[model samples]
Target: MIEKLAINGGKPVRDTYLAYGKQYIDDDDIKAVVDVLKGDYLTTGPKVKEFEDTVANYVGAKYAVAVSNGTAALHTACLAAGIGEGDEVIVPPITFAASSNCILYCGGKPVFVDINPDTYNIDVEKIEGAITVRTKAIIPVDFAGQSVDMDLICKIADKYNLTIIEDAAHALGSEYKGEKIGSIADMTEFSFHPVKPITTGEGGVIVTNNEELYKKMLLFRSHGITRDSKLLTHNEGPWYYEQLHLGYNYRITDIQCSLGLSQINKIDEFVKNRREIVNRYNEAFKDIEEIITPREDEFSNSGWHIYVIKLNLDKLTCTRKEIFEALQVENIGVNVHYLPVYLHPYYEKLGYKRGLCPEAEKLYERMLTLPLFPKMTDKDVEDVIRAVKKVVDYYSMENCPL
Candidate 1:
């Protein structure tokens, strides 16, 4: 009843994981990176700037600042958005930790909000209830590559004078109301980790249309060293630079940017493949009463970064853990997308308690991400379908189906 995965199953899980998520690399992706390696600049250089522009143009943003990693992008966005000590940032509990961690980095407290189980997004209706004088911003995570209800979230932010920096790490190719995820949010952060829709090996970028924030992000990307002389009052010398504020060394290298550029070319291809896989999974699970499948809203299109399934806990004859373990025994590797951020011991020790976000806690009890990636083939898809079916049938409370 609690979980379907059996930990002590007396069987090895996977010699090599059919990981819940992973990256795909081709010869061309390799060649572009090699070309950068052969070039003169490796660290934050011309290619990094080029990569920023490429992403900006693709997402319809005025500026993009490439950073060392996704967490860095979130941290920089937090600072640029004017979040700091004594501020309270509203965020949903159904997200990866960095969404809240970024707020803490600015000495701000993250106010956890529950999500709408249907879309698995931060419930915009709950925003007004969470807001207080200390509130600084609202970070709505686009869970599973589906853009959160941005229009409503923005409307609430406008009323409260709060910033909305979308935690769009999983939404590169996702769209909301036909507008790209990156373009609609006041500020959106993207990850180019290998497992993401686009891979830069390990990199992230912040995209925005606000000019003042753009400059601040540029300065923050490289240890707060502003080389532009026009902004400074005194011209010390041609080589002079100023550490305008306490920033970080969160710059992305040209080598990574080269990989990103190459990956950009295949983004549409990757997205198409992921969509096909999700469709396959949807059809395979359509009639199974024991499991509830993923739901795609009529208004939004997901990049399908993850094909997460929430178990019909009330219907399943077997525990959630048993199903997970059953699949693992057959080498059909599966993983959970998250344990609610507030459920983590660190969050609990920080005074966050259970029931703070009831819906998210209930969701964490059953949410599991199935294997999904651009590289999956027909055989791989069948393997997963067969594994899940076998597990369900074998554990049926009724007589097993043939």
Candidate 2:
């Protein structure tokens, strides 16, 4: 029905708008939440523990602690790692601000590390040069569902005596070298946001094999208060409790955990479908010179949260914004994954400046996230591909100079 590109006064790809990511809730998910609502315990209840145990088992971790959300998981992990004032944490600049903000939350300084231009993860080689006596930990993000090189990162941590808290917020189903993500890092954090591999409305969990860190994080999520018999110094009566340390009210609700338990049952299917969509996108755009599809390391089996495309500016007549807006004009709801974390005004106020991570800053200029969710039908996927091709073709330059 369409003869020309929408950006050039032609018909658009589709009549409806498609977002980059979305939740796929079904009848089972609904029943789980409804069942929780009708149950006795609502807040800190049995379902939370069940969900935590299930996730821990799923990821091969010894313990798991469910928290209110992803940021809380990061904060709790930071506290468990002993981050505090005068401490420094190494993190990639090419990720969500929460990855770095978690360090700030713990009274520690966030040292911005550049990304690998090929994989868009933190450059592990650059991490060593950034380390100092104050450096306490490294928060390596599994950006866009791909796992980082944990084997090499572990060696770095061992040499420097630094902790590793994997911000695997996008990588619940991802794997590294045939091993699952949660079991690979010292402590791994997962998000259960609607847009993630699974949904819990708003929830997060931290998993670890270390019993000490697990115990520390458990208390940290509950206002530093405990009523446990072993933890209490003086059990004057059944009601007696103690505040072990300064912590936060980061506990997740049973309702969310109920939804999470249901969601985890279908995580495999969710990840498989996401991979199929990514494959389709890659094949569709393979011959398009103006676009470069995302790449994963050979060791990474990505969970495929979002599929991003990088623009070849020299080969395109239009700018990155032009291509992004043109896609929007064609009913494609594309987005940018992130701007460099330190580039935000708040980070600038904290005394960070430009030229901190040149690769990340450059990546921001060309990156554009496309629509990719498990709920998308075949037609929806085709519509996105057509929309992208139309926009790129309209703006492409055959012989532009770099």
Candidate 3:
């Protein structure tokens, strides 16, 4: 017999709600933070530098600058890239607003690009069509921890002489053609939010191979105030500094970096575990006609930040919202990954209208994020699978066209 859905007052798949993403904080992480708290310097300290160096080395980048959060990282990267008024930056519409908002922060216009229907990343082939004489850069996001086609993106950037600011918030440990995400782009930014692969309470970092850009980011994060004698116009004896540019106080605290240092030590294991869970999810849903699993490209090894599934709505008797709610009733904390950045009222007020990216808007209507985290046990994975299957089974239609 087909099981009754919990939304219809039947038994739930699980007793407790499972969040879509969560941080895995162990005793070691707590100890690392405590060690920093007990030390002399809590804000501008050795721990922050240590964390930055570790990340840079791990990603094979020449330099890394730690900042208050991911948004600041993007903003500082934009500032370092010399993005100014009237400059245009190409960005995909499927990502978080911050991806494009950074361009706006630098007084630049963001030209929205559509995503490839399969990868849900910016369509590389269509990128050149959006470029104009005003175009200055391209911000390619590695959506859902899958690397964008860096080789193709690099070729495009080189041809246009445009800088590539990779938003790698979802893809720290992900690799493109055997190279780490952070090392491929001109400047790559990573987030250390609670729900990210690692947690620093709230923090971010930008990695780059260019020393000029690295130095600029360093100055930008600390209010453009520099005590370095090489940078100062005129230095007085011992105590002297200069505020060369209008910059924000985006410095990250050592306390957060301490946690980040600890968490990063386990990143490989975390990524491995996430991939294992994704494998389980893929296998469980492969036979379900009403579900379309995420696709990882041949050259990309994803870190699997969040497992997203697109419903084959025609094969089911319900809408995505109905399935989402049904999964919630079954104690599965299903959620939408995002609405297109331009669809938000704020962007709409900025003169971005609908039909800008039909593919992104269509995908938005059918996509759902399932529970995915490094700490999720096998049972947690099983519960999510059972809940989704139960909901889809209850709503599935007969003789549905593929």
> Which candidate number maximizes TM-score?
3
Candidate 3 per-residue lDDT, tens place, 172-280, comes to: 8999888778997889999999989898988999999999999999999999999999988998967888999999999999999999999999999999999999999
Local distance difference test values of all predictions, in order: 0.86, 0.92, 0.93
Stretches off by above 4 angstroms in model 3 are 399-402
TM-score of every model?
A: 0.95, 0.97, 0.98
Candidate 2 global TM-score: 0.97
Q: Write the per-residue lDDT of candidate 1 for residues 1-402, one digit (tens) a residue.
A: 322323335333334457777898899989988998898999867999899999999888989999999999999999999899999999999888999999999999999888887878888888899999999999999898987887788889888899999999998988888877798777899998888999998999999998899999988888888879888767889988888889999988999999999999899889899999999999999998777787767778999888888887676666788778778776877888788898889989999998988888888878878899999878888878876776676666663332
Sort by TM-score, best first.
Answer: 3, 2, 1
Better of 2 and 3 by lDDT: 3
Candidate 1 residue-wise lDDT at 223: 82
Candidate 2 on 131-198: residue-level lDDT in tens? 99999999999999999999999999999999999999999999998877899778999999899999
Query: Number of clashes in every candidate structure?
Result: 11, 0, 0
Residue 227 Cα positional deviation in candidate 3, in Å, after optimal superposition: 0.5
